[model samples]
Target: MSFYSGIDLHSNNHVVVVIDEEDNKVVDKRIDNNLHTTLEVLAP
Candidate 1:
């Protein structure tokens, strides 16, 4: 019941993805580079 996340950061935006323990993708998104936006997407 655990999850893992990875992000590919760029100057203007970021590509983020999250996967479960079984390696199934749970979340996939492209978000602004802004810190608040990133945090919101990552929030539980």
Candidate 2:
């Protein structure tokens, strides 16, 4: 299956979302601006 992701970035936090090819949500949450945290949430 294929997946897609998007992020709304701000100064201190970000909202990240991941969806499948079928438009089903895989991950949808807000995370800290830290790269590690963002990557962790984006991980498959």
Candidate 3:
């Protein structure tokens, strides 16, 4: 399986989108604007 990730950075927060090769979204949501939290959320 393959995955594609996109990050929409805004002034207040960030939107994350994780998709597959067929453009099927695996995960989509918004998170707090912070480096540590972002990494933690993305960590596997």
Candidate 4:
């Protein structure tokens, strides 16, 4: 299986989406607007 990721960054927050090889969304989240926090939110 393969996976992909997408992130939408704004001034206040971030929207993250993860999809699989079949193009099905696996994870979706709204997270804090910082590098550490964003990484934490997206970490496996």
What does candidate 1's lDDT look like per residue over 12-41, in tens digits? 999999999999988899998898988888
User: What lDDT does each candidate get?
Assistant: 0.92, 0.88, 0.87, 0.87
- Between candidates 2 and 4, the one scoring higher on TM-score is 2
Q: Model 3, which residues run further than 4 Å from truth?
A: none
Model 4, C-alpha of 10: deviation from truth (Å): 0.7
Local lDDT at 9 for model 4: 88
lDDT score, candidate 3, position 8: 99
Q: Indicate whether candidate 1 or candidate 3 has the larger lDDT.
A: 1
The TM-score obtained by model 1 is 0.88
- Model 3, residue 19: distance off in Å is 0.1
Model 4 weakest lDDT span, ten residues long: 35-44
Give candidate 1's whole-model lDDT: 0.92
Residues 1-44 of candidate 3: C-alpha lDDT, one tens digit per residue? 88889999999899988889999988787998999988876775
Candidate 4, position 37, lDDT:
80
lDDT of 4 at 4: 94
**Per-residue lDDT of 1-44 in model 4, one digit per residue for the tens?**
98899998888998999999999988898887888987886678
TM-scores, all models, native as reference: 0.88, 0.88, 0.77, 0.77
> Candidate 4's error at 25, in angstroms?
0.9
Segments in model 1 whose C-alpha atoms lie over 4 Å from true places: none
Tell me, by TM-score, which candidate is best. Answer: 2
